[model samples]
Target: MTRSEPDVRAEQEALFSTGAEHYARHRPGLPAVLFEALPAGYGRPLTAIEEARLVIDAALDAVSGIAYGVAHNDPELAERGRRTLARLRAERRAPLSPTGDAT
Candidate 1:
């Protein structure tokens, strides 16, 4: 005997129904290192530092959920994120020397 499509959908729905709140509360967010990137750039509106932090936190948490899924090899969504991160590492730019040409 084979399960009907509705039966499969029902089972999947039940699995997440109980833990929705836990999922929302325990999620991770942006790394603190990213805050340096948010400084004012000429005419941009000044967002209150507190409000800006909340937004950044929410964004980080959301993306971390995505990255966690991707990192663990969830093929269903594994192809959906940044293609470069797995292969490429980031390099910080070196500061220019106080003296003349850095060359």
Candidate 2:
């Protein structure tokens, strides 16, 4: 039988609450290699639309990380998520030229 929305939500919440501690304890943190791989800009220049698309993709990734962090009470993950989100917001506000330079 299908469950109602509220019922599904309540069950999900219960599962998350019960599993959060285990998840926080067992989950591995982000690798140092990942931080090292982040660069100041793309290797090659991109158009304004390309830059915008990159920002949107990064924002979606950050949001997913934030949601997982919150659900599992992972402070380090949450902090990284916040930093990624802030960077994305700044990128979104700044205008990009056709050559991907800040305008």
The runs of at least 3 residues in candidate 2 whose Cα sits more than 4 Å from the true structure, single-residue gaps closed, are 1-43, 94-103
Work out candidate 1's RMSD over C-alphas: 19.4
lDDT of 1 by residue, 1-103 (tens): 1234532332222222212323443443644333333332113443334233333343444355458767887753333223222311242223334442232
In model 1, the clashing pairs are 28-61, 29-60, 29-61, 30-60
**Cα RMSD to the true fold for all candidates:** 19.4, 13.1
TM-scores of the candidates are 0.26, 0.45
On TM-score, the candidate that comes out on top is: 2
